[model samples]
Target chain A: MDPINFVILAAILFAIGSAAVLLRRNAIIAFMGVELMLNAANLSLVSFSRIHGEIDGQVMAFFVMVVAAAEVVVGLAIIIAVFRARQTISLDEPSELKG
Target chain B: MVNPLLFWIIAALTVIPSLSLLFARKAVHVAMAIVLVMVGLAAAYVALGAPFLGVVQIVVYTGAVMMLFLFVLMLVGVDQREDLKETIKGQRWIGLLAAGGLGAFLVSVVARVALPVQEETVGEPDVIAEVLFQRYVLVIEVLGFLLITAAVGALVLTHAPRLKPRRTQLEVQRDRVRVGANPVNKPMPGVYARHNALDVPALDPEGQPIEDSVSRVLKIRHQTQDGAEFRAQLEDPARKDTEEGR
Candidate 1:
């Protein structure tokens, strides 16, 4: 596929994911949006890396996958703890940490 | 031609569900939307010729990570009653202003700046790795350490003391009784033993005298049968009353 086509599709996915992350109230859903955004960036990065015929992008993408996995584990654990303590999963209620 | 058309179709598929993620009130539905987005992205990655990354992205991000998220959410019982509200205050105005400013800046820059001149094409994947491991090895090692620390941290956080049902008051009292002590409805050590002396006989099934005799504890009514009760003093008050009356 042409790099331009790849770039455009990725941009659209990223934008939509950004909107979801910003607009949603549910933390899980917001988390999904974040995943969407990351994948969007990954799509573009891998595509361009291929265009340039470089393996670094694939390796970086691998690192990103690992990091994203770690993030989900830690992030969800925290979210679970927060929900346990607060008795709610609404991201809005956690705003008490505002300083 | 087919590749571009397929890319556009996949983009549409990706965008629509991602938008749905924002609007859906139910968290599970939103999770489904996110799964759709991840699958779409993997397809996009495949289309871009990075099949390996595409598979890893799906396996790690969608299969492992998101599943963990869903599992935790389910385990924690995040139901419809959780009452999700927007955390960001005045976000609408901020988002609007930021978007507008970025758009205006882009327009001005696009008008003034020439299109980027492409750099001389770099060769194969090995070159990228050569640069990375050669110069950026320290950064890579740090990232690995960061991930290990994170995994351990997550393990500690989620592995809290399991929520076993708490021991009930009766169970506690029963335990005390079985241990030859009174846990409730009685004073400190020796006091309750003395108090229940006349009524309870200061002994269990086997015969033995109780210690620490007291007058006050003898007043409580003890039931010998259903709907029948008598004062502890009834058993031994004559000895005490005869002396006191004299």
Candidate 2:
């Protein structure tokens, strides 16, 4: 299989994830979209690692995974706390910061 | 020869579930879709000859992170559905247009670039570990600190504060008489105070149930089970439990 196929697939997945992040009203779903985008980048990294015959990309993928895991914990905590304070998870409802 | 068909199938699996995740209405369904997508990505990693990455993807992303997401979702109650109404005017159109534009640009660049066809490297765990601990050891240590920060930050963000001021036992008795509910000193018969009776949720001074998401869900459930009479008793605190007389 051509490595470009995997790159194209990553591109498509990234697009879908970006769209979800921008369009979804739910904070948790938008957070999931961010995760999807991160995974797409990881896929591209692995494919490039395969094409170049190097282990650097794979190592980078590992670091990305660690950061992503940490991000999910902090992001979900903030989301849950907001839900508790306001009783809703809709992004539209938290316009109190609007100046 | 590696099967091109397998790559195509795995690619389809990866893309389809991610799309479904965007469209899923409930948070639980979204979590499940993310799990499927993570598994598909792991298969794609194995197909790309990164067995170590595939295994890590499954263990970390699918196993630990997704489990955390689902646990938080259940704790926060899945009954809360997002409002589908567009919050920002034309936000959906703008998002679609931008995503489409970006995808087109990336696809064009990818199609035009020439990737050298080299022998695929098998990323064995030993080689990855050696490089990780040797060259990237500092990064790994920093990541450990990051994880610690994340844990502490999550705890701080989700910490629930005490709802009311602590009162002395004598003060509690006076307040209980003022509110005219159950006496503070007497425990209900047959119910161990610590086991069941002592933890009876305190109502607001107005005798209304606390307005929180979980209690709101439990209230709805109670209403559905007992129908109109139960709902009336809930709304009116004046009604005594006639069943307790038996």
Worst 10 residues of 1 chain B by lDDT: B222-231
- Tens digits of per-residue lDDT for model 2, B59-110: 9989999999899888778888778778778878998899889889888898
Report how far off residue A25 is in candidate 2 (Å): 0.6
Worst 10 residues of 2 chain B by lDDT: B187-196
> Which portions of model 1 miss their true places by more than 4 Å?
B81-141, B161-246
Q: Quantify all predictions' global Cα lDDT against the true fold.
A: 0.65, 0.82
Off by over 4 Å in 2: B163-246
Tell me the interface RMSD of model 2, in angstroms.
Answer: 1.3
Superpose all Cα atoms of candidate 1 onto the true structure and report the RMSD in Å to 1 decimal.
14.4
